[model samples]
Target: MSAMNAPLDLPLHAATLNPFIAQAWRERITPALVDYIAIPAKSPMFDADWQAHGLIDRVVRDAATWVESRKVPGLTLEVLRLESRTPVLFFEVEATQSVPTGAQAPTILIYGHLDKQPEFSGWRADLGPWTPKIDAGKLYGRGGADDGYAIYAAVSAIEAVKAQGALHPRIVGLIETCEESGSFDLPIYLEALRPRLGEVSLVVCLDSGAGNYDQLWLTTSLRGNVTGTLKVEVLTEGVHSGDGSGLVPSSFRVLRQVLDRLEDARSGHLLPGAFHCEIPVERIDQAKVAAQALGESVWKNYPWACGADGGLTLPVSDDPVELLLNRTWRPTLSITGVDGIPPLAQAGNVLRPFTAFKLSLRLPPLIEGHEAAVKLKTLLEDNAPYNARVTFEPDGRVGAWGASGWNAPTLAPWLERAMDAASRQHFGAPLGYIGQGGTIPLMNLLQQGFPQAQMMVCGVLGPKSNAHGPNEFLHLDYAERLTASVAQVIAAHP
Candidate 1:
């Protein structure tokens, strides 16, 4: 059925909206999330056998079944698939309102992901990734907070808007299952759905982080990422360290030297100029505002280790603003994993022939991820010390290795007003803006696809939510409030 603008004689009040959304979450969404957390629906990258395991399909079907059961007034849902690619759930809700005659009905694209990161270690004794448990108000498990709850929250928001007689624009949902693997398959799916997606005017992405869970955090910028394996081989086989100690170059040492070219070992700054870009003044100013709001918590929120003397491992900088900028606007490298070193328990006195390190390079928002990746490979492999055989294989082809970062377009006046209003109503505080250190590849694509779209990039991964790590959880109260706020914002679309 075609949408027609309906008059909202009695606007939905916060008093009514908040309780209803909260109840929906408790009775309907929470149980489904428990089921979802138990699915072990790891992303395709982590579970190369995802198709054979059927976990991804199970979760998708489960979510679709739940949405269908809701029977949202005008929602139509489908599971879109391309052979040899992960499936995505596409759903749409007809508008309860329209624009001026002859103007295109503004489309709000709701985005989220169902796939989860791998089950990392360090889980509490009583908690596990696939084991769902509710402690305090947090639902503890993998993917619950990193946004396995997105589709459920989104549908609940739409339902609340319709139930309260609040008029909304045409809303569409695009939930993908490969987000954890950098969303490599998303381009094809987006291309296939382009005609049906219409001209998007806003994107409500629920795949980001919040500063305090006190209010909605509008993601201002996201750092890009390039991941690859850097390997350095010195000899064909291991030799006795005592015999080859001075005669041969250590592979690990060679690899370390190569890495030194990329980052300053002491200051932790990326050395390459091409990997960085000047921070936008607006973002820097926003960081100051966020710094005032967060204060020391900006660096204190992390789980730092205690030294032998009892002093906790501190961040690179003690200043809140620098800590925020270092993470959000600066390029940095993390050696996530390494190979060629035997466990100490093995007690081998052999000199390893090769060393491999998994390199994860985060770039500033304006730097191109693919270009940086190619340059990164050249930086490490060129002029190898001792002419050791060195190789760098990025996640993808040389041209496009990983996801690019996103700098949000200038906020539309209506959206800025609407967001503040929603946050104040639902959270009792005005909206907060912060730059997150994570990467959501879809944001870049959506911005390019809809240059004029207003982005409401917000999420429930607040301090200590621990996304993509053990003890990860979703704050129940916060999620419920966020859902209501999302509904309020959707209803306010001009």
Candidate 2:
């Protein structure tokens, strides 16, 4: 398990290490990685009772200890407090080798979060969500894949390169714990460490995914997200359903009618002016390639209710490109949850007096966050059918970001080559580029700060990885291979 073993004499480039080093790295890391996956650092959003749970502090201290023990050549490890109450463990690993003279190499930055989504109990067989269990080549645990292993993977990759005396580029691992909750505290932490986060040229984020386990998915764009609560008051108090059936206007009905005005029920397209955006030509091309690779398995892989009409109600694009473009480059609205409504088991024969719903809006990268929010709120407020008292309050918002046109010429090829090498070594196929549906707000901010820096977003969450849902698991072999791929990217940077 030690990273200091004599470095293998393999060539540092992708073609040089392709078939052999990639497999060796996966075999070496698989066993010890399970222990790293067992920590339960559930996100603060779902684990509001985190302090009483005791896992948060344990996970942080464990990571700090791991970083300290490594003694990376010039790096300093310390657990510092940001904003007095927020505990942030900072690991500053300095560059080991001097840059070649006259070389315009920029200091590469790698970012990941240690926190994970909450895991509910009741898994099948003997599996418990918190207990790390490896079955059929998959690692089942809460934070194992979402991002817990990203920091370890990044450091391990660099260490492997260093062992070979092939380490030339400067890599800094910027690990955080609040990414799951909209990364609310990141800007503050970034400001506090402004002096130390110097001269960055490239940022590598292992927080996203590919469409499948076969290809290395590179994210070119991210959708912005806005979440808020909408409350509608229809009556002063609840009334008997039999008596109020026709007379009283139910809040649920009013809410549904208002939402219908904002979206087309059949096509799922946003109403005019809700938000404006253009789908990029590059994204459209990438989606088409991904769809062809996925095939019919795409629809069959979804874990939905049994006997559900698979293709009847579900809309399938004429081609894979359209499907991928709709998900990545377009705006979407969904009703996440409703409050003031009792479950079927607690059902009562009464018309509810008031109902509130949580709505989530995903905006295209071209739209501004605040502007989208304002447009959505205005649309909903104006369309209220029953003149119901409707109120919209912002819960959380993260702006969408378009990829900078500068770095792609250089960074994209490096990533594609690294991914192709890994995939050919592991699965005997070439890697591909794909667009993701989720948002990583910090990527846009970091890009803004260092306009000239190259950026690449890569990770291990593919279809059925179920990041924020029940039975979340990380494909063990895929993650290990991904770690090796990251190593290749760092070593191959020229």
Candidate 3:
């Protein structure tokens, strides 16, 4: 967005790019994506019997079939399955433009995933997670924007480039179905397919969020995640509350006390020093810029409940920049799921034996996820309140922990110029940079493997296009322009 950013090269068929992508989404991708949304292909964590359901397999096969049917020039698609892991769809588009003599063409690795989060509660009367509907030009459904649209957009971008007979390099797409579950299965496939995944100079990950739908936003960093269940037990069996009132300690109260060690209940700040990291100066500056680009909408966009007195409810801070830093650069804790609680209607005056809560801790980008998980387990499980039995069990391999976060390498000058050029060409605005609070395990993996690769991490999860929550929708107009923007970047790739 700066005055020095590279000016756009005459767009290779710029006049027709949007029309081509728009038609592609309307006639080809949307219908298929609709079917994709309807499948309820929840991630493995949500559906333990995913294999028996066969939904993952069906969606993979369908996506593979659609790609093959595209018949793009020099394109070959494969649905790769590792004995027990979820499937990944890998496709390649050979270089089209003549490469300079003595220079190997650079490879562009476009990454996304087909897996989706579980169908959470609180859907609108007309909308459901699996029911795809088009209202007001947005496609309402889960997974459609979160990532099911990635492969479709990736191929369509290639097609747009080829349709113009534009100069383009080798491009490969890696769409896995386990991303929502921390991408636990991806490392294996990355190793097995390492040889095939050529010198990847660029990674176009279309699974992050945008500051807004008005302009292009690049994710500069992502927070890591550590999730596990913490349970506290004080009694072997349930007893009437009146009878056990004074004798037995409350499991819920004891569990809360243990969690107090990890987080400040009132302020919501994670207490451990290991969970915090130094916020890079560049990221702080970018957050300020992004905060300006998107003002109060940064936090006000969230659906917070009204206060008891009918006044507005507030976030941790009202400062836009601080809120941005808090979500992206700082660590926080959330209780996602719970057990050992009775429904209000079924509430018996009984003392429960145990209380378990699913804890999801978001860590700063530099903190190691597994190490944090280990530390969290120790912090909570060590000191027993009233000597109550408290245990912390984490998800993922014991040593590996959950997903570690990623901070992208320094932006390459060429890629920065290309991105700004693409943004100007498509959205009539400069490109924006923001750090996303969500974790993308694959980004860290790819950065570790290709340390020099410039990451183009952008997506359609802008404003209220909630990916995991109900009423999720994909802004069709923005997506169409974004598709064209991606094509522009690829055409500008050196």
What are the per-model C-alpha RMSD values against the true structure?
3.9, 5.5, 1.4
Ranking under lDDT, best-scoring first? 3, 1, 2
lDDT per residue (tens digit) for residues 233-334 in model 2: 888889999999798888988887878877887788987664647666776776777788887555556665544665344445555667677777777887
Which pairs of residues have clashing backbones in candidate 2?
Answer: none
Overall local distance difference test of candidate 2: 0.69
Q: Which stretches of candidate 2 lie over 4 Å from their true place?
A: 1-39, 49-54, 84-86, 99-105, 120-126, 307-318, 397-427
Off by over 4 Å in 3: 1-5, 97-104
Writing each residue's lDDT as its tens digit, candidate 3 over 232-340 gives 9999999999999889999999998998898899899878898999999999999999989899999888898889999779888989999999999999998999998
Model 2: lDDT of residue 306: 44
Model 1 pairs in collision: none
The 10 consecutive residues of candidate 1 with the worst lDDT sum are: 1-10
* TM-scores for every predicted model: 0.96, 0.86, 0.98
By summed lDDT, the worst window of 10 consecutive residues in model 2 runs over: 400-409
Candidate 1 per-residue lDDT, tens place, 1-494, comes to 10112222224587788889989998999999999999899998789999999999999999999999999999999998899999999999998865687878889999999999999999999999999999999999999988989999999999988888878889999999999889999988999999889879999999999999899789999999999899999999999999998889999999989999999999998898898899999999999999999999997888899978999987888889999999999999998888888888985889899999999999899988888888888899999999999999998644669789999998886777777777777787878999999999999999988898899999999999999888999999999989988888888877
TM-score of 1: 0.96
Q: Rate the local accuracy (lDDT) of all candidates.
A: 0.90, 0.69, 0.91
Give the number of colliding residue pairs in candidate 3: 0
